[model samples]
Every structure is written in structure tokens, then in C-alpha cells.
Target: MNVGQPKHLSRFPAKTDLTHQEFWRGLPTLQAEAVLLGPGRLEYKMLQVTGRDLLIFRSKVAPKMASTIVPHPDWVVLMVPVDWHGDYVFNGQVARPFDVFVSGGPDGYSTTGEKRHNLALGVRKSSLKEACANLSGRYIEDVALDDQQIALGAAVGTRFHRRILETIAASLEKSLGSGKFALDAVVENDLFSEIANLIMAETIEQNSVSSINLDPVRVVRRAEELFEDRTTNPPSIADLCKAANVGTTKLHLCFNEVYGVSPIAYLQAKRITQARCTYLSAEKVPPSVKDAALSFGFTHSGRFAKRYRYFFGEYPSETLNKR
Candidate 1:
């Protein structure tokens, strides 16, 4: 096992003296401390940057008119609207609920009022680069994921991302580690990487939406159906065209326009994700990467490895070993 000490970032005890009115003044200070140094606080919880790519943040901000927050050198803020809605101006763009946007550079500000905020997970630039090396400094200033609006409560991807956010929050609250040990250190890093890659994949799609034109809703649905049926092997672009009843060219255009990556690339990523689950499960002695690649219609191991690493920031072997 890897040996390391738990990095002790600050931990705040629950404060009873904090009034709702005083929340505004304290919010920036908390965020600054966390983003700048380490963990910072708000209401009953805290925000912790676990590693290079993951951020575990849970805060309840009362209300405020306008507040400014600068970016940190290690992360780019991508807010996924959970329980509140407001105009967030980042790099001169106002992001609304159900809308995925990123603050350019390493800093930005947030403005909210009387919103019981749940969580805001920050995606690390390094983790993202590890996952999508081809992106190489691209989409650095934008949302970085698919564009089709997932209709506040219905989008599958949206729901998945939020679920991850909630899971991290829950995990942090139940953590037994004193923030300084070996086992805990490894667990924290693993969890952080998992969260980072999940968010990174989503943001990559979000930022690339302009290049894809297929209806976001439809693309999500079709992709889900395709992924659910493991037995059925279909060509990505053609299959999307067939599923959506659009011509090949239109399907390609729309899918690329809405998701940023070609439909096939997206499909490949989905397949790889499926394989990751299988490989990580204790009930199975997962297929070799080559066999998994073939099962997913990826015949070329080299190409599959490249794509798999791009989607998840690690090779299939590395991921399997983690299991």
C-alpha cells in the first residue's frame, strides 16, 4: 500500500454565533481560505480541496447582493446548480440555473441571495488534462461539457453530476479520519480522483456543446439507451442517426454541435465507463483490457487506450488495478 500522512487542512467546528445577516461577510473569507490555502467554512459544513482534481465543498450562504471571489492557481470553478438559481457573472458571462459555465483564469465571483446552497464542486485543471490530453489548454475558460439543456429536473447527466456532488458531501460528513493518516490519505485521494474525473468528463462535454447541434435532451436519451443495451453493438454516428431519425450528416452535425466531441467518441467514452464499473467490481475478475475493448467495439488497443485515458485520465489497466 502507498504510505503517506494525512494532510491536515483546517477544520471548523459548528458555530452557533453565526447569524444569517453576517453570512455575506464571512462567505468570501471562507472561500478565500479554502481556495487559497485549504478547507474553509460557511454554515454547518466546509469546503475541502481533496487533491489536484477534486473539491469537496458544502456551504449554506444566507443572502447577499454582489460578492467577488478570485480563482485559485490549481482550479477552474464550474458550478452545477443544485438547490438555487441566480445570475453568476464569470469573465463577463452571466450563468443561470441548469446552465453549466466556468470562470476563466483561476478566479471569479458569485452572487446569491437567501439561497440554501448545497454544494459547489471544483474540477482541477490537472485531473482534467490527465483525462483529456487532446483538450490541451482548450475550453479552459468555458463550462467544458455538453450543451443541450437537461431541463432543470430531467437531464440524466445533470442528475448524475448532482448525485456525485451529494455523495461527496455525505462522504465528507461521515469521514472518520482526523485528516492525518495513511489509509485515510489513500481513501481521500481515490475519492478525490473519482470525483475529479466524473466532473471533468461532464465539463468537457459541456464546454464543447457549441460544436454539436443535436438536441441535448435527445442526445442524452439516445446515449442512455445505447449504453444500457450492452449486447447490441452499433456504429456511433449511424446509430445516433437511426435513433433520432435524422440523416447521418445532420446527426453528426447536431451531436458534435451539442456535445463538442463526435458522437462516436462520446459513445466510446460511455463504453469505457461501463468497463470501468465491471473492472472495479469485486464480484467479477473483469475482462482484460483487450477483451473489454473488443466487447465495446474498440478493436485497436492503442486507440482504445488513448481514448480511455482521454475520457477517464487513466488507462484501463491502471483503473482495474485500483479495484
Candidate 2:
């Protein structure tokens, strides 16, 4: 019976372009961290809207990078790619334009890409479950209640993908926050029902890699934890292997399989990324780049600057001067 237009939407201004920091700060995620993988400055654009029970974002980013995003604890996030100029990986799976990547877990998801355009929706788990239960047309049995994260995909011209586009349009538009009307319960139910029906729809079109063993993922995660916790002395391959409880050969294989990089290089990339943060936030130039480098375990100035440029697309001095 509810008929009012949406008034629950938060008033986040639409953005045409943003710096890497601005873009990361704006994502509705918890403890989100991003690292640059390609050289040069990054370009990003984001249009965002939020509701009490949901958040929607239309965004694009360039120059290729990786991000570890931990979304709201009570919500299930769905990422739909509208344009993918290069490989886009989400949760270690290649995200195609046809599939809607979905996840809701404590561990969150890892995303990396270049020249990617996407629509992301974060819907409250309780609200979504209620909507699925109350859907009038679809039988209750169609919607699986399993807790595992999954990507739902269908062939082109299918109703599911079309409805996703429609959802993105409605969720990202300002109309939801305009005027006297409110997005009442009835309208919300209808919207969620549309999503629910599509998600539970049979015969999804999917041709992705088969399930991975997941042991490699665990090894990488353990190694990251050890590296992050270490100070003054970086762990050697032996230490990393001991921490990960795997042999050196197995550790290398796992790291490469998971991140497409060897352990040492990948960990080094992470270490320097912390230094970039200090530069990004510095009010005035820090006393010296070498101080920052040496503190983060970079002893050789030439090697530090070269690696910094590769990861952030700028020299340490240049990044220090940006702000």
C-alpha cells in the first residue's frame, strides 16, 4: 500500500572525477585499502547514492590496481560490471559484464582491474531475505538460502541482466532523494523482489574456472599477516614459510597462483604502499624521503624510488609535493 517516493536516500554528491585517495575514501566499505599496481596517475569517477538499507555506486577507475574491500558487516554486496577494458578480478574470479558478483562475508573481497566500469549495490542481508520470502510471484523454493557467496549470470537479452541495469539506474539516480515522496516499504519490497527473482532464476549462463583448492588463498593470507606484523626486520623466505606452515617451493607456487607475483616482490609492494599513505596525508613535506624509506626498511635510496614510481606512478618526492 505504500506509494511515496524514496526519501531515505542519503545526499552524496555525484562526482565526475576523483583522485585515488578521494575514490577510496568514498567507497562504503570497512577498512578498505587499495594499492596501485601500474605506473602513472590514476583516474576515477564515482556517482553514489545511499539508503538506510542499501548503497549504490556507479564508478570507474583506470591505470590498473588492487583493492581489499571489507564491506558492511550486515550487507551483501553485488558488483556488476558495465564496461571492462581489461581483466577485472573480484574474489579471485574474472568478473565479466554478464555476471553479477555477490559476496557477504567477514573476510570480504579482493578486487583488481584496469579501465573498469562498474555498478555496486550493497543491500542489507535481513532486508533481502525478507524480500525473498515475501515475493508474490516466484515460488519460495526457487531462492536458495545458502550462505556461500556466488556470482549470478545469465545470457544477453535475459531479464536478469536487464533488471540489474534498471536497478543500477534507479539506485544511483537523485530522484530517490527528491521532493516530498519517500521510498516506502511497498516500493522497497518490489525492488528487492525483482532482484530476488533474478538471483534465484534457474539456468544462469556461467563459464568460469572451476572451484580452486583455496589452500593457496590461506597461505597468501597468512604470509600477508606475518609481513604486516613485522617491523625493523622483514621476514625471510624461511620465516614466511614457517608462518604459513608450508615449504618454500609450495609457498612460492601458492603466492604466484594467488597474486601472480612472487612472495618477496608482492610483500615489498605492500610495505612501500604504507609509506605512500604518509606522503598522501602530510601537511608539509616530511623531513626527508630517505627517512620515510629507511623506517619502512628501504635502505637503498635508488631502489626505493624506482619501486615507488612503479607502484604509485610517481617518485616519492613528487607524491610528497602533491598535497
Candidate 3:
């Protein structure tokens, strides 16, 4: 995470020649699990300001996709969806285009949308606090908690909020022609301050609740971690419930809220992903598809092949033979 000055400052054309791996590698932060939901080629374009701890970027994704993201630890992202129609799920709560969302630290989030254009700014936690304090005379000590609560409470956007977003976009467009230059610290600070002031002045604030009530998100995250750790020997639903300290019914609800799937189904999907990775990475005489599937906990080869094809749009054998 070394921030350097952006060498290029132009809005590039929509790049359609990226593979799934290439697209994932280009993302600034966040570990994403992505699934292309449409048949057409994925189209994307980005305008980014490089080389500063406080960075601004706008990107558009066409031909719908579903993605789950784990945010970066040191940055807080404020995102405004332009020409975006879909819901973003954060901590089990959903936010729409007119709602601005904030995220900090490592949190799980999911976005499913069609042809989305988003303007996002990533600022370090310390810079964000300084900006907010300079603008509003108040500081946020725990940004991740505050952002989660805001998302859970559904912070709605107002006319002024829309105007702020428009202004920010306009500023980015103007700066695109400025060429490569080291971003001045004072200039970066002022820019962040302006954005923070707009957010503070326009967005509505709700009451903060205690952490005891927010245990469901934590439980779901813990279950996901456990599934990842023991992919070959995943825990049963009952075992997961015991580990998460929740009942079967509560676990189901939490899993559905976060992943749109039951715990068992999510685990199965993870196993399939692991199997695909193993199949693709095998070198010097790859393993048979059956062996790969069974190695990742797929008991029945036939069922595993069907599930793998359905999820990845290719048969397991096809993937196994590619390399």
C-alpha cells in the first residue's frame, strides 16, 4: 500500500479485453469474489488520480456481475453510484444508488448490479478523521463501526448530497488534464476536507446501537472464515451454529442476509472454487478432474461436475484441460 503520484490522468476508453484474472488484479484494494452474470463481454473504464494516500477514482462496469468484497484494512472508501441501479449489501443491510455508503477496515460487502458507474474515493483512516475534524469540528474514532451502523440504519441521500457528488465528479474531470504531478499535501487535505464537509452537511445521521445487537454479522463472518479454513472437512450446520454461538434458524437467516445462500450451499460453492483453482494450477501432468473434485471435498464426481459447470459456465474437465 505505498501511495505514489499518478503518472497518468486521463479517462481511458472502456477496456473489453480483460480476463477475469486481469480484472481482479486491477482493483486497488479489496479481495473480491466475482461472478459474471451475463453472456456478453465485460466492459469497464476508469479515471483515477494516482500517488496520494487520498485517492479518487471512477469506474463503470457494464454487462452485470455479482461481487463480494473484503475491504482494505487501512483505507475508508466513500462511494457514490452514478447510473447504477442495484443494491449493495453491507453488514446485512442494503443500500441503493441514492444512498451513499462508507466502509473502513476489513468488512464483508456484496454488490450486484447491471451497468454501474461509480465514483469512489479511498482515504486513509487518519486522513479521513483529520478531514472530518477540520470540516465539522467532530472526529470519528471508530470509522468501521460508525460506517457499519450508518449502512445498517440506511443513510439516505438528499438533494445537497447529489450536488456534492456532481461537484466531485466535475472536479475529477477538470483535473484529468492536469497531467502527472506529485500531489501536494495541503491540496490533498483540502480536497478531503471539502468532501467530508459535504457528507457531514448533507447525509442524515441516526442513533448508534450497541455491539451486542450486531453480533449476527460477526457470526456470519466467523462461519465464513471457518469454512475457508476447513474446506476439505467443512463443519456441519450444527457444528457451525455451535461455533458461531447461534441457533440453526439464526444461522440460516444470517447466511441468507449476507451471502444470499444457506451456509451449506455457500460452503459447497467455496469448495467448488477451491477445486477449480487446484485444477487450473496443476502443472506437469494435471490431476484428473475427479481427483481434483474429491480433493476439495466433492464426494460425488457427477454432482460435482454439474455444480462446477453451473457456477463457472464450464465443465470441470474443460478447466482441467486448459492448462
Candidate 4:
């Protein structure tokens, strides 16, 4: 389990990360990889407190768009996004600011993006199961992976969000700092019991919500695979269509639904950043700007430069020359 160091707390406590990737994101224990989906330098931090039974963290990431695969597994996790000011999508669902993301029953895979001021907690699945069984006086079946809207009453959501923050604060004080924070078993039990009770009470608000349409997820995932496989020569719309096996209309709608951008626009943004990576990581040969663009299948030099500048805030030439 990778734990976070309380770096920069004295000088920049607001920016310190109490939990590194593994403690909150389930690294090494399970499979996880993150690819940045937005432009500019990534500003990421987490304020986290962990116990043997549970781990909670406040994640703050800017240029927040990301494609994450299995960040948490064998753990039931919830995310309360606080002050997520703009559009965001989780899996195939367009999430509201106050919405809670309950996942980790069967498949804990999630891809979320844009603005992510989120407070989340992960309880070991077996522990949660035992808790629910003991608390509810019966075997409990918690929610399956929620691939749909889960409406949270405004007051209830806010209250829970505050509670989570308070608990973290208290844990920090008890541990004496963020560097060596861990929840006492009693604290963990009480907090986790609340989560279990919430689930048992069916407070997650999914019954009335519509079931998620998986078509978009399938479409986008297929296209993403194509992009990954053909990075040296990014696939055309026709190629994407064939690979995804969807018509142009369905493709456009589904792509926009999942990523909030049309296929072409998302592709340009993704592929352009990749080209910059190429320039930065080039070993033997000093890759020229033109070569980088062409390697990412950008045929039109003017369009490539424009897209590069638009996404990265600098011209491709500037990046290559710097490299």
C-alpha cells in the first residue's frame, strides 16, 4: 500500500497530498492507470487519512479530465464532489456537483473528468459486507455498480460531505499531522458503519433514476482502443466507425455524451498532447515538430500547430525546440 508523505504542509498545506496514488487509488493491489485528458500542467493533490479498515481522501485535481482504469478494486468507494464547478462525466453518467459516486461492487472501473474537487472513501469490500451483516441483522446486498443517476437530496448530501471532511480533520489532528495519519479502529468502525447504514437505508437514490445507456461507453472505449493502437497514424472517422461498428450519427451522439466533445475535437486534443510527449521522450533521434505531428497522423501542418497551441498553450515548434 503506497502511503502519502505530508510534503509542503508548513509552506503549502493547502497543496499537500496526504494520500499518494496507491492509498486512495488502489495501485499495486489492483490494476490502475491514468491518462490525462485535458491540457496544461496537471495540478493534482490529495488530503487523505487512512486506517486498516478504511481509507478516505480529498482529491483535488485541475485540468481534471482523466481516463482511469480500475483505480479501486475490492473496495466500496463513494465520492462527494465538492465545488466541481463545470461539466463532468463519470463512466457514462453526467454527474451533478453534489452527486455521490458509489462504485466497487463488481466492476470498480471508472473514467471521470474535468473538475474534480471530490471527497472519497474506500472500505474493504469484505469489511463492508461484514459490517452490513452485523448492523442490519441480516445478510445485506449493497448496490451493484451504479451506472445511472443517483440523486442526493441537497441537505443530506451537504451534511455528509461536511462529515467526511470533519472526520479527516480529526484524524489529522490525532495523528499529529498528515504524514502519519491513520484512523483508530473504533473511529473506522463508526464511520464505516454510517456508510453501511446509509446503504442499507437505500439513501443512495437510484430507484427513480433511469438506467445508464452503455452504448456510449462501448462506442468511446472502442474508439479509444483504436487511438491507442494506431498512435503513429491516428485512425480516421471511417476507421473509428468501422472499429466501433456504429453509424456516424450514433457515433457523434455517443462520443459527445461520454466526453462532452465531438470525436474529432477530442481526438485532436488527445493526439496533440501525445505528440508533445513524443518530443519530450525522444532518445536517439531529435524529433522535429513536423515529424512529431506527422507521427501522430496530423497531415495538415497549419491545423496541427493550431491544435497544439490551442491545447498546450504553446506552439509545437516551441515544444520541440525546448526538447
| Alpha-carbon RMSD of each model | 14.7, 22.1, 21.1, 21.7
Candidate 2 clash pair list: 5-182, 5-183, 6-182, 6-183, 40-313
Q: Which ten residues in a row have the lowest lDDT in candidate 4?
A: 1-10
Candidate 4: stretches off by over 4 Å: 1-29, 71-73, 140-149, 174-180, 203-323
| Pairs in clash, predicted candidate 4 | none
Give the better candidate number (2 or 4) by lDDT. Answer: 4
Q: Cα lDDT of all candidates, in order?
A: 0.46, 0.60, 0.56, 0.60
Task: Report the C-alpha lDDT of model 2 over 1-323, residue by residue, as the tens digit.
Answer: 11121222213333568776666564456777778899856767776555567665667776778988777676777776655656778888876445677776777888888777676777887766544533322233443433233445444324444443343434332353321112223224334545554454432222122235648899788877876676434554444655666544566678999999997677677768877876776465564786676556554557889999988899999986776
Task: Give me the candidate number with maximum lDDT.
Answer: 4
Global local distance difference test of model 1: 0.46
Query: Considering summed lDDT, which 10 consecutive residues are worst modelled in model 3?
Result: 1-10
The positional error of residue 176 in candidate 4, measured at the CA in angstroms, is: 8.6
Clashes of 3: 3
lDDT of 4 by residue, 1-323 (tens): 11121222122134364323533343323555566776745555766677886887676676656655453456666766665545666667777645767776455546566655667777787777655444333333643334333566666776676567556655554463544466644346456656765665553332221224547898789878987787655665545655665534456777899989997677667777778778777575657776566556553467779878887899978876777
* Range of the 10 consecutive residues with the lowest summed lDDT in candidate 1: 1-10
C-alpha lDDT of residue 12 in model 4: 18
Q: Candidate 3, residues 1-323: lDDT per residue as tens digits?
A: 11121222123333234444554464456686778887666655655554366765556777678777665676777765545545544445555435556666466466777767666666776656544443232335532224632321213344434333333333342353432123333235335545554455444232122235756688798777776666545444434654565544566677888878887687678778877877776455657886665455453468789999999999988886666
- Name the better of 2 and 3 by lDDT: 2
Output candidate 3 Cα RMSD.
21.1
TM-score-sorted candidate list, best first: 4, 2, 3, 1
Clashing pairs in model 3, backbone N/Cα/C closer than 3 A: 4-51, 5-51, 6-50
Give the Å shift of residue 289 in candidate 3: 66
